[model samples]
Target: MTPIFPAKAGHSVRILQLCRAIKALGHELTFIHVASKLDTQKPDIASHVAFFGERHFLHLDNGPRQARFAFWLRGKLRRRWRKILRGFGHDHSHYSGLDENWRNPWSHQLRAMDRRFDTVVVEYAFNSRALDAFPASTRKLLDTHDAFADRHRPFVARGFRKGYWVSLTPQDENQGLRRADAVIAIQAQEAEHFREQLAQYEVSERNPEIAVVSHYIGLDQPLPDHGVDHAALYLGTNMLSNQISLRQFLEHVLPRVVSSIPDFRLRLAGSICNWAPDIPNVEKLGFVDDLRAAFARSPLSVNPTIAGTGINIKLLDAMGAGVPTISTVTGVRGLGGEFNNGLLVVADHDHAAFADHIIRLSKDAGLRRSLGLAAFADAQRWNERQLAALDHCLRGDALTDTAPGHVARWRDRTPPPFPTAT
Candidate 1:
């Protein structure tokens, strides 16, 4: 359970949910958050989940290993020392997704502590160090939240090769699949895509024991009234995809919207440094403490995303707050909805046309409110409870009787092949 991303990112959030759900199922849970320093901005989120069970931090020594005489040999000694250390390297705090380089510290430790657990639930494929460390007896499993290799397409498309991200693609991903006891895809389409593409990436065609698991949300209690904010808002915490989407939006559409509507302010929030577009209507709100509050303040949430994987969490948070949304098809792909009727899904990729639609929604309060209500209701189904099966799977509590559906679908699905981490 080494959190590869910062504690607040979607991966960490899902990990916390899986662990807690597993704990509730009468199994023990442990979280190994590796790091030299914890991202202190949000200790409470981690703290809330801490009450359930074990939390450990394995920090490796930071002293330099390279000397002037044998700089080239430094890598050799470092590799040996890495083996000696065997668990938990420096905390990769800013990594939004998994990278297969720098032997992850936990894989080795978990491999050594093999006796403690019967199965290894690898949340991401970056930690091959763990794959090697995995006990011979313990089973391995992967939850393909995103096509790990797809994220690296940018580097590949750029003609660059033999870098950290390049190695993570296909190789480590396939290794994870081949070695794992099972592979769980977040969406059905994605599961099919994984099966079809693994072979293209030089992975086995007889895909691993694949299963489709929906993204988890905390689908508990009657949603409270999300008081309204009339402004149109966009929020992102420095994800590159978000930046690309924002750039597209500003470059193509904001001028028309600002000119047409006097009060229309397209507020941009989150970790965009020096990214204030010169467009008249676009206002940068910066990152907020609780984005839910920002959603509460804005009646309309915009999802101009072009590329990203997994459920857009910001969309769900907005839906949870009962905020009406206008998102591109890709952005709205996995969010809960009925026949595409739940949210104001806009297919017009053009920013001006999309902004025109936004302007129209802004004028009509009834249409805006309806979209929010329906979206909130739809979000109820995908909440945290849905991940119970995933939790059970991770704990090796997924024997047939307990999860016959899972067994029928997954137990028979042959083990998948994933690439070896470089």
Candidate 2:
């Protein structure tokens, strides 16, 4: 069960990719979408039907009216309590939206289903409550897109008033984790964090097994170089973190790049363009229908992320398309360092060096082609490894050599040799 639809957002991409992978593994799928109260956009039901088949696709609206009214009444009371707490200088950081009571209405619906499921995979820890609807013998897995314990701290430290997505206290998050038979963390560091938190909280007699299953992208053959000279692409949604990173890149790095190569052009795509500043040589291609075509038009991609958790799917998408990429160290977090042959990592806040890499790649078509080839090769190998790991995760098998501390086994290996020809 998931709250998000299959869309272009990073998390949504991860969901769709996993679903496809599961189907490819020959297992039938039943998709349950529990719509969030804050979600205003309607999902394209036709696309969902095409992907999951109409019979298997289930979209649950915001429950019955009585349940909705109860939830609303509770929310009002909580707000009143929050206001009272604020006057006394107390902070309440728990996210009530994750409360299992919010999903109570659907429990009966899920229980009423005539079919039996061997395994039930819930998308987020907050939605893990859905697992309770199944028999105790059925396997339950929780796919945590990111760590949520004190999730708001990072955004708050970055000067934002609140976190972009969900935030919950350690105790609250631990409650969700205890319900899963195995927990799927998107990255290694987060896997370790979950283990530590579960141990610390002693939430259950046995903590759920934690598995590291990073994002996967299908590898594409390198397109013949038809890139615009001195042009780079930055594709992202208008999330607050994306806004901050792109704004900083424009303010600090773009000027130096333009000064060195006056013809330099930056292509901004997706909702990010809505907030993009009007600037010279910056072309805004809003809501690109064909991302592969967009990647083909640019010789390289840039992920200037200075803050955020989990792997950056945009970076992975660029690598999958065989485009040479430059990213801040934080941007490449949770990704294997072996892929560095195709990805250039710069220290955060080092604007001059970031610009230097951009300038260098813009001027060297041969180097760009070489790196893009390496990227495509790396993406192929990475996809295989992730698919194997995900298969193990779905089968409830203990992943060998993938323990949190043993990340070096996969992440620190020497990169495979780049293909001599593509």
Candidate 3:
């Protein structure tokens, strides 16, 4: 089950694409999800769920009397608990800084709808607890969006809390994956990591089955006009990691680019615009309904992500839209053989170099056109390869090339398209 409706978020896009692909391959699909109480914006849930033959939304019981009494009892108990913990010189922080009832609070409802499907795919590590509510006969699949233990490093390093960090510890990820009959990681690196982790728990030669299925956008040909807009698009939600990346882009990269290329502009789209800095020439277009129109207006896309795990689908989306992209190393991980190729440019987290690349590309119309076309081609190839891997994994194929080190078997040795091509 997903934590929210398929808004413009990366995880949401990945799930919808996978569901559509699964359905297109002649398998029935259904979605089991919980709503995010804090987000009032309603995404097009009907259109997304239309691919699936069935849908179920699990809701929590919250009568007024029950809510008031629960709040009162929680406050009373929290005060007493804090007092006792303080007496022992321990920090009694807020109880589980996660969404309320994140641990399968609606499992009773989920359990009732369990037997209808032969296989259940639970998305996100936090919602893995829902897997436990399913019957033993049901084949459970865990779609881990990222390696959370690694993803939480930035938060942990910022002194978030031991309790919070512990919640995403490696053991916690292991617990979630261990429960699944099969596991799907978004990146190849993470998929390998899961196999190693599961090996420790399994006595046999094979442990929990695992596969790498990257996000597939299946975008059509390049945007028509590559000459009109000199804007660099930054599209993403207000995820903590995205906010950090956008802040860095504003503070470090945007100024240098604008200085070198006076005509350059930056457009921030998606929910992250809520907290983004209002800088000169940087327009914040929050929650745009048509992302392709935004991409069409911008020739270049930049991802200055400082800290995050898993593949950045935003970067891939830019590539899919047939636009030239520049990203830091952290933003381009798990892109086998795509890094530093002609598909996109890469800068070593250096703002000056990033700005220079932006300036260089801004001046060369031919380079931009060629790179965008090449990116479109690469996206098509990667989409095919990833789909094949997904089909293989779903068919219960035993893990191949299970040797220790990082496997590069999926890499395409074909060279990127020529930049001089029309």
What are the per-residue Cα lDDT tens digits for candidate 1 across 298-388?
Answer: 6678888876677776676666666677888888765434423446666647676688777877666677777767766655534432444
Q: Candidate 2 or 3, higher TM-score?
A: 2
lDDT of 2 by residue, 147-212 (tens): 888877677667675545777778888888878888999877899899999888745787888887
Q: Give all TM-scores, in the order shown.
A: 0.72, 0.91, 0.80
Q: What's the CA error at residue 390 for candidate 3, in Å?
A: 2.1
RMSD of 3: 6.0
Candidate 1 overall lDDT versus native: 0.56
Name the lDDT value of residue 29 in candidate 3. 63
- The regions of model 3 sitting more than 4 angstroms off are 1-6, 36-45, 48-105, 159-166, 198-206, 339-347, 398-422
Q: Which regions of candidate 2 fall more than 4 Å away from where they truly are?
A: 1-6, 83-89, 93-97, 398-422
* Pairs with steric clashes in candidate 2: none
- Worst window of 10 by summed lDDT in candidate 1: 413-422
Using lDDT, give the best candidate's number.
2
Best-performing candidate as measured by TM-score: 2
Better of 1 and 3 by lDDT: 3
Every model: Cα RMSD to truth: 9.0, 4.4, 6.0
